[model samples]
Target: MPSTNCTTIYKLVQRAEDDDIEDVGNQLFGDGSSTMSVLEKKKRFEELYGVVRPDAIHAHPPNVVKCKGSGSRLPSKVEAAKKAAVKPPRRCGKCHKMVNHDSRNCDKERSKKQK
Candidate 1:
């Protein structure tokens, strides 16, 4: 072995600027010989292919909260509480009745002319 450290190999691949020195096949995957040391293989794989990690593996940062639900993410605690806390029905000042509509829009007065 002629001192093929990761940095040296990486530099060679990166510093190639000539037309004859086109980049290695981006789509190519390398399977270094089983006999090779784990570290050596990883370095060789990186030099021939791309970076240490594939692009797809790191396109998006990992989420802190893992969702085990059916595809859809579970709602946060705050959101769930908001949904669960139902607002009490408003009181109608006109009739002292607790209902949806307020006094201004109260339908309690049977005849409008009576008001």
Candidate 2:
């Protein structure tokens, strides 16, 4: 089975592929700015191509349920739930602090006047 991160990334790539298809559709149909949302575009593409509609990969929520079923050597479901509930990790670009916000997007960096 794929690691959680790998599964998540796969979903993101699939969504991106869908987005690219939608862009092409807009070009072909010349639908002036009334373009379909990603979900709608994906549905249309699946219908036209006779392919399965891919899952919402970007919205890939972790499977805390699996953690629940596994034994103690594997973290308990409660622990998995805690990990899932915790805010996502962020790395700062400048100070490199793995705090709430990363350095690249830090306000301090944004405030710096370029020489």
Candidate 3:
């Protein structure tokens, strides 16, 4: 079975060319899976490197905080959250399933039986 460290190891391989590659790799492998908790990793890297990582790591919405709600409020909150969660929608023009995901993400409505 492949270890969870596979990803960190793969990254070590990919980033081997960078100046800080050795330091990052050492941090990752030194801690078992080298999978630092997201917050810890972010904090550590920002402290050490003096730069923020990419949007993939930091894209959580600022105004969003989770709390319990019920009934109409829950649905309304969900709809509003969805609106706040907007990314450019990736619906396929042909089938309209979020084809941006993978072929499996192809929309059922969009997938027609071709004769």
Q: TM-score each candidate.
A: 0.19, 0.26, 0.22
Candidate 2 C-alpha lDDT tens digits along 2-100: 699899999999999999989876754557667667777666767667889655656767765555646647788999879867978678777676655
Ranking by TM-score: 2, 3, 1
Where in model 1 is the C-alpha error above 4 Å?
1-85, 108-115
List, residue by residue over 1-115, the lDDT tens digit for candidate 1. Answer: 5666877987777677542344342213233233556666567678666667554654677778855564977899999878756667777888787765577777654355377
Global Cα lDDT for candidate 2: 0.72
The candidate that achieves the highest TM-score relative to the unseen native structure: 2
Ranking by lDDT: 2, 3, 1
TM-score result, candidate 1: 0.19
Q: Which stretches of candidate 3 lie over 4 Å from their true place?
A: 1-20, 28-34, 51-115
Q: List all candidate RMSDs to the true structure.
A: 15.7, 25.4, 22.6
lDDT per residue for candidate 3 within 48-108, as digits (tens), equals: 7788877766566589755656435345777877875675657565555653433454554
Q: Once model 3 is optimally superposed onto the true structure by TM-score, how far is the C-alpha of residue 79 displaced, in angstroms?
A: 58
RMSD in angstroms, candidate 1?
A: 15.7
Model 2 TM-score, 2 decimals: 0.26
The lDDT per prediction is: 0.63, 0.72, 0.63
For model 1, what is the error of residue 22's alpha carbon versus the real structure, in angstroms, after optimal superposition?
57
